[model samples]
Target: MSEGRPRLNTEMVRLGGLIKQAEQALITAKTIALKQFDLTVPQYAALFVLGTTPEASAAQLARACLVTPQTMATVITNLEAKGLVDRSTSPMHRRLRETRLTDTAIPVLEGADRAAVQIEEALAVEFSPEELRSLQELLNRTITALHQLG
Candidate 1:
């Protein structure tokens, strides 16, 4: 159609742009969320994953955070240097370093969580409950379809 030129008005193309733009905005808000703790958004994400998974490898954490292993390594190194997290050889996989949060990180993560919630609440104030539910359902279906495609 139209000499094979790309069209931005297509449903999928518009949906992809919306998702990307939302993610970028969320990342910015999360960065502000963790700024008080002197942590970057990725660092906060890694810490949260480590806190939950306890002794997770950087690669696994990277996959969970949707970042490259190389980028995750740098985030892990930074967390380790700050004494917010520690890494040791995994019992089952000796080569992989298992990482977890330190005692100090819990409080910081809690504060960051609150900040993130505030941002989320502010964003959600404009949407009705039904709209939010519908939006989430559509997003889940889209994600499932993309996963199947991949």
Candidate 2:
């Protein structure tokens, strides 16, 4: 509020920093949670996607993760070596292979979910429920708009 000075919203700048901190915190939590299962961040992402879309192809997963199909192939290869995922002919398309979470992966996914919940809870002390929900919705809209631009 100074004369001849540009105005800036302090809240926006603080929120940006919060977003970066949140990303780092979540990644750290994921690393710790997945250590016992020997999964990397990308491997966990692939498993989470496969668990949600049990018949997704590696190509689709690559798109979701914003990585090359070749990169996804390597991630899948690692997951397969760990027995966390299984690949087979898609029931919808015989020529296309579908990837899915294996039975063992279900428990791992559950543990990841629990870890995420714990992270959120630990961060919850900083924000009210309504504020958290509003932040979540805002981020979802931002992501949706970004994807729509592409």
Candidate 3:
């Protein structure tokens, strides 16, 4: 351990492990829920971003979705093939392509959103509103602390 740094304890280690496990569980549940819409988690992430940021570049989508540019490119190609997205030359940057969700994707996203929301609601129901608020604050602080280390 570095000078002035606190030593790790079992509770700290367990907290990290629990966070990872919770994340994996959420992903697995989302994977199963998204299957009916023929969407992968990454695909859903991209669409969810595009829903609010229409005509966004793949690079922008990649950053917003926490994916690499190469991965976003592939996802865009697949979505295009499925008629879920359309790409066009950016008016301001002719060399760049902008992506947007198609009409076909609207209904698919609606259903997927409902399924995802149901999972969130189920989780929220397990905690009191005050507890949920505190958890959210703690998670936000944790994220900020982690980012400060980088």
Candidate 4:
């Protein structure tokens, strides 16, 4: 389509296709480790976010997890039901619920984290460190570029 650039089918060679397939693969593999603890991806996500930001409210965690507040409500409910997270009325804001991980949840989350690391390690086995670093740098640039476009 361009005057002098190499032409290719956009649909067949776009970033979205690659990104989506990679996500699906990772999710399928991750779901198994999480299932062993009776958790879903969103539930595990809630625990990880709460552990890092204990003061965050459900709304805040929802935004961080890239889900709507309504969907996150379900995630919080499941995590609470499993005793993995403790939700308290926010002292600073009566309408908000501040959430955090329970002591018993740490080991489960750690196991899930280990499982994720193993998946990433296995996926990276074919790549050299330099190649991986270059890919990361390029992906970072692409993300920044897309954000600027938006």
Please give, for residues 1-150, the per-residue lDDT of candidate 1 as tens digits. Answer: 697887665455577778899989988987887799899988988887876898898889999988999999999999889889988998897788889899988998888778878988998887899998988899899999999999
Top-scoring candidate (lDDT): 3
Q: Give the TM-score of candidate 3.
A: 0.89
The lDDT, on a scale of 0 to 1, for candidate 1 is 0.87
Selected candidate, larger lDDT, 2 vs 4: 4
Quality of model 3 by C-alpha lDDT = 0.92
- Give me the runs in candidate 4 sitting further than 4 Å from their true place: 1-12
Candidate 4 per-residue lDDT over residues 35-136, each given as its tens digit: 777878888788888878886788998999989999999998888888888888989889888888988899988887777678778878768999999888
* Residues 21-65 of candidate 3: C-alpha lDDT, one tens digit per residue: 998999898899899999998999999999999999999999998
Q: Write the per-residue lDDT of candidate 2 for residues 1-150, one digit (tens) a residue.
A: 679998886656675577789788878877887787677777878878887777889999999877899999999999888888888997778899998898999998778667656766887777888998898899999778868988
TM for candidate 4 is 0.86
RMSD of 1: 2.5
Highest-TM-score candidate: 3
| Over 4 Å off, model 1 | 1-13
What local distance difference test score does each model get?
0.87, 0.82, 0.92, 0.84
- Give the range of the ten consecutive residues with the poorest summed lDDT in model 2: 9-18
